[model samples]
Target: MSASHPDNAPAATAASAQAFQTRLADRAAAMETTLTEIFNRRSAAPPRLLAAMRHAALGGGKRLRPFLTVETAALCGAEAATALPTAAAIELLHCYSLAHDDLPAMDDDDLRRGQPTVHKAFDEATAILAGDALLTLAFEVIADAGAHPSPDVRARLTLGLARAGGMTGMVGGQMLDLAAEGRWGAARLSPDDILHLQALKTGALLAFAVEAGGLVAGADADVQARLARYGKAVGGAFQIADDILDHEADAETLGKRAGKDAEKGKGTLVTALGLSGARAICDELIDGAIAALDCFGAEADMLRHAARFVGARRS
Candidate 1:
């Protein structure tokens, strides 16, 4: 079902959102170039490994998470360009997660981004190593130059990113998801339970993305709080939308296997609340996300658009 948001801006008003997507894609390509050059500088890094890393990371993605990092920083009066490395680092980590998630032990999918998954394109071992490399390199990129300006701030950024991306964070959420397969479904989760899972699994990194930029820009406590709230709401909305797409979108449009969640008996908002219910929850979450940005005044327009766009994203 096409969802309706309560905010004044029609979702279609986010026309500039598509331009942001293109800009993010271009920036991510440059990030890949830099990473490749750094790896090639060291002859010890195997060409095959490098190829696999690039294959997964440089593969097509919406780049929404990274763009959020950059734009959030910009909204706080910092130069968005200064946050490129941080943005790139987050994207690399995200790609790593996708690669591993598609492995035999995880989601066990064979396609990603309309092409062979990393494990399918190469060997399983190669795919594992590629994920490892990207995860490690993500830190290197973050520590390079674009960190929040102060050494303590930089350290905080590192810690936040690690927590958001590590086993205690996204991984923990994934484990819960895996465990919940065939058992919990969506009906079992209290709104609180749903919030708990999404906060860690989906919200944590997004919180980090927005907060990292704010931290870099030396945002005050109030700004950080607002961004964090916005991040959490959007993150939950994003997953809800994904859950909807899992049931509604076709594989060709989704760029990966659709209905995999249902096939695997995984719990999802739709599975819990049914289609209309999930869509309503998504709209509510989007409203909450946009509301969190009210403190930023008109400057937060992009963020408001982004929140709506997250709910509207197809993949």
Candidate 2:
């Protein structure tokens, strides 16, 4: 089937949706194989450390961010092969975040991807080290000539990934999240405040994922900006969906402890807006994401499906 779809058609029919799912699974498997091989080839690391790193980085999850990176690159007319390393780099960073986020000092979760979390299966210190190693490796992956033949493209990917994962982005938003728990006696965040926090903490990397493709393909400035906007909107929808699921999903379905946000007093959009209101916001963000891709015409149908999937996902 053609990747293109009419602007007014459903984002995906059952068959097309299955096709998208197949594509997502294929990319995810490829990413996992690449990650596993990278860890297996490392001879200098201690056994436990290597095992922990491999455990945290090599398996599980939807691989959505990498999918976005590859798809966006494809949409921008670049070959998927040209973008695979960068996609892998994004997944490495994402896994690093998940490992760290599940630490005792953070979300304190005991499960991830239907397995014991890094900190649970391994010692906390090892988990922390593994996360750190994965994070650092992400930069190395992006900066390597394998990610892009052009030195400038590799440099741009490195810089963009750094900014997206740095203090002013994911880390900064995490800090805000901790503070919102009244750890420092800060007031409970308003709806707007929660939105801003999620935008930075969760949205930044997603924005980078979409924009990374444009960067790799050397898309013009306007196209890049539009993709960035699309990323931001989708990111918001993703978090809201997460919040909704947290409130409603079981541990088996969610692959983590549910309702921990409220238990920990973390300020979520759901907390500030209520369930129906949060759903409304999620829908709005999905619409905005789809609109942002209007310029890409039928070439962006898969991305539009992704936006809808994020909003409607049950887990």
Candidate that scores best on lDDT: 2
| lDDT score at residue 116, model 2, on the 0-100 scale | 94
Q: Rate the local accuracy (lDDT) of all candidates.
A: 0.80, 0.87
Give the C-alpha miss distance for residue 198 in model 2, angstroms: 0.4
* Candidate 1 per-residue C-alpha lDDT over 141-243 given as tens digits, one digit per residue, 9 for 90 to 100: 7876545557787788789889999787898888777776634444355656666776777778877888888887889999899898988888888888888
Candidate 1 regions exceeding 4 Å error are 1-3, 6-44, 145-148, 182-191
What's every prediction's RMSD, in angstroms? Answer: 2.9, 2.8
Error of 1 at 12 (Å): 6.6
Instruction: List, residue by residue over 1-315, the lDDT tens digit for candidate 2.
Output: 223223433546788778788888998898888777767667688889888888887778888998899999999999987888999898889889999999999889999988999999998999999999999988988998889999988888999999999898898999999999888896678899999999889999998999999999999999998998899999988999999999989999998899899898889988888898998888888878888887777678888888877887876
Ten-residue stretch with the least lDDT total in model 2: 1-10
| Angstrom error at residue 135, model 2 | 0.7
